[model samples]
Target: MSFADHTIRVRVPGTSANCGPGFDAIGLACTVYNDLELTLKKEAGVKITISGEGAANIPCDGRNIVWRSVQYLLRKAGLLDQYPGAVIHMENNVPLSRGLGSSATAIVAGLKAANVLIGNRFNRRELLQFATDIEGHPDNVAPAIFGGFTVSTVTRGDVECFSFLPKFRMKLIVAVPDFPLSTRKARAVLPAQVPMADAVNNISRASMLVAALCKGNEKFLRNVFDDALHQPYRAKLIPGMYDVFAAARKAGALGANLSGAGPCLIAYALERRHCEEAVGEAMKAAFRQHDVEAKILIMDLDTRGAHIVK
Candidate 1:
């Protein structure tokens, strides 16, 4: 579980947190990924290289989330004081600040790198807790660490989560608009309080959504994603958000949802995979009506979260 040499590469999957009604609780990991490679240096200095997504905007220094996460894990493990310098290289595919859990990938990658470098003193459970602590929530981090489907929460200042291998094999179609929606800005639009009716509605739908996914019941799934919680308030930020959902459904999607404080919309399919193209086109057309271009990605669930490549 440990490497004597300070060179290792790790891959972490991209994550989409909150599948409609399960806000800050459910996270789904996709096949898209971010890879991080670290080589220990003899001298006390670090070097970094970045490609893809926010490569131009992201920092290549200690300020980078990946780098900061590396240091954070090392410190927590009591290895920082004696740490050697390391060069970190990131090959990123997940879009930053687009609600695809880019930051969660970076955090998981860093922790995995450090664990392997130090002989993996921590187990996956420990690593997941550490990652959740770093990310300040388990939604994205939990799935990024455990992959597949995850349900997570913080209980009494501690992280509690579990992963599930879904009974249904679902195809995910993610359509991202040209514009970005920061989680901060999206949260700002929501009212501080909601009516008891709205709260009850989300709870009912969330329960049904979980049941549908577990039983592979597409009939129940079709109507289960109607969330009355976060989406309605945040839809104002993304032009045509609801329209895109409508379009995807019209194109044969079993259910459609805003992917985590999105400008990204994700849909599940139960019918012909050929309908993926139709759904993608429909979503894109909806975005174009608002003058925003978009990208539609077709992916399956990632069964594995983060792992090292020898």
Candidate 2:
């Protein structure tokens, strides 16, 4: 029953939660990913090797999020003593603490890879619940598990998610600012209660957003990516946030908003129109206007959420 001979590799997408109006409810899985390779060791120490984004700051010991997640799952299955150590390798393309769900990516990758190593005793839904429990929300983890665009809600302690992949092609233009805004700090600025009007606005727009994305209705999408819930409060954390959104829209983007919490902004554009570059540059230049240097990444929706590569 030893898993020392099994090497599991899993790829998890970087997720953008909130999706403008659907605060804490909707998420989109992008093409950018973090890949994890996990090999159980018969010995008793955890070892991690990381490359790409956040490698310099990421921990390589038991403190590492990837290793912690693996340990969590293994402990749940009562296999921690039998497989007390692992060699974990992570190649991360997702930025850290920049609203790109980097932690969710790590957690999903670890859980998925660990499950594969243990004979996949956990199903995707079970994995989603485990990830949600660890993440404190299902927005990012749902899409990381199910892929595509996900609308999730937690009821009584269970996670229910509906995932959709639109037939039409769309490009995602993300402008990553130079600074990082932690989710805790971003959320701290929010008011405990919002005006009923703002709440109604978010409800309407979030519903419209889900419907439009599900139907691939481009006309409806143009106005639905606006938020009245978290974005306005979180905007102060990211300089020129609204200006970046305006620049993207003025450059023929359908819409744009904060990717998850703050700092990184994502814009949507039709693939057929070839306006992605213009939108990306517009967002980047807007950040430059505020003396913030930003990097732009052009990506598409990831349909396959997290999967074993080997």
Candidate 3:
């Protein structure tokens, strides 16, 4: 088929990073996504079009994450000169800097689109590594690449990923406030040094959480989501953080924590009905208590990773 006859579209899942004590090592892909359409043109230049959230703020030129990802893959495969220029149209649904992995989704979508446009030259692992390099971390990129709930660790300059299909039915309730907190700013609030006791505490909790997930033991998870490394320090940045967690627990959620950075809290529930009601009530009470408008969503785990639609 001619390049003009093929249209590549990729949908990438948004991720919630640092689940409880996993801290930069675990992530789950949610139902939210960003869609990208790539059409090869007979012309000689690259063109980019964007719509939806962050359209006006995101870069539209070669500096865009999507553009950079595509360019990186094409160059790595040594087909940069042979491939025809293309037009990339992005439809973004995930909000930026709200603790959602919106940037990672855009990068993964672009890489998937480029790979399809070039006839699947790179495997999923290779594509993930490339995207992770661009993202500077693998928590979000791992789940966005492998889908479902993923436990990842970066060791010796490489990312190790393990995927788990949740045995128990679980729903994620996310509450995003109107105010945005940049991930960089949130990181700044964290302390550089931590006590040994705190370190051991998080290690045990992280291990327990992972074991509970593997065994599908909800009881073990009831108190296993505690974190001593990041959440305690970052909680200062989010107003009424304790109240949000308290509200979620009171509403029958298993556990709740700051989604990725701050301002967006995520709660885990076993039943859809309970989750829905809990999310609604938690959002209302959280907003009332914190004096900030918030939006709440009930999202499921995304099983399929980034892929081309056509």
In candidate 1, what are the lDDT values of residues 13-51, reduced to their tens digit?
999988988888898999999999987554676799999
Per-candidate TM-score against the hidden true structure: 0.95, 0.98, 0.94
Give every collision pair in model 2: none
Better of 2 and 3 by lDDT: 2
TM-score of candidate 1 versus the correct structure, residues matched by position: 0.95
C-alpha RMSD of candidate 1: 1.7
Taking all chains together, the TM-score of candidate 2 against the true structure is 0.98
Winner on TM-score between 2 and 3 is 2
Could you tell which candidate, 1 or 3, scores higher by lDDT? 1
Runs in model 1 lying further than 4 Å from the true structure: 1-5, 271-273
Q: Which candidate is the best by TM-score?
A: 2
**Model number with the top lDDT:** 2
**Backbone clashes, candidate 1:** 1
RMSD in Å for candidate 2, one decimal?
A: 0.9
